[model samples]
Target: MSDTQGKDGLAAATGRFDAALARLDQSLVELTNRVQRIKRIEVDTQRLVQERARLATELDKTSARAKRLDDSAHDVSRRLVVAMETVRAVLAKTE
Candidate 1:
């Protein structure tokens, strides 16, 4: 090949190499961004799982308290009925 032709071929090859390098850099940037997004989603999913567990514990405690309250109310109602009967018996004896 002539000197000019050799120089021209080398320049063309260098241009192609530079273009390929630029495309590789752009792909790397995109891949990095996608990985970061996935990490953020994972963190968010873990947070939601923890929150659900906490809420379930809270609901269990509240249900236990309500059951105790219901039992106490039933006991009070029974006592009230006994007292009313006693009052009625005493009034009948007096009459």
Candidate 2:
């Protein structure tokens, strides 16, 4: 081949290489952005999971407290009934 033709071929090849490199750079940038977005989503998901766990723990504590309150109410009701029976007996004796 003539020197001129060889030089032209080299120039064309170099241009193609440069274009390919530019495309590669662009793809790398896009990949990096996607990875960053994924990381953020992962962090958000973890936070939500932790919050849900904390709320569940609070709910369990509230349920236990409610159970205790119910038991106390039942005990009070029993005592009130016994007092009323005693009062009725005393009134009958006096009458």
List per-prediction Cα lDDT, in the order shown: 0.99, 1.00
lDDT of 2 at 87: 100
Candidate 2 local lDDT, 1-95, one digit each (tens):
99999999999999999999999999999999999999999999999999999999999999999999999999999999999999999999999
Candidate 2 clashes between residue pairs 3 or more apart in a chain or in different chains: none
Give RMSD to native, each candidate. 1.9, 1.8
Alpha-carbon error at 39 in model 1, in Å? 1.2
Error of 1 at 40 (Å): 1.2
Top candidate, metric TM-score: 2
Using Cα atoms with residue i matched to residue i, what is each candidate's TM-score against the true structure? 0.80, 0.81
Sequence-dependent TM-score of model 1: 0.80
**CA displacement after TM-score superposition, residue 33 of candidate 1 (Å):** 1.3
Tell me the tens digit of each residue's lDDT in model 1 across 1-95. Answer: 99999999999999999999999999999999999999999999999999999999999999999999999999999999999999999999999
Q: In angstroms, how far off is 29's CA in candidate 1?
A: 1.3
RMSD of 2: 1.8
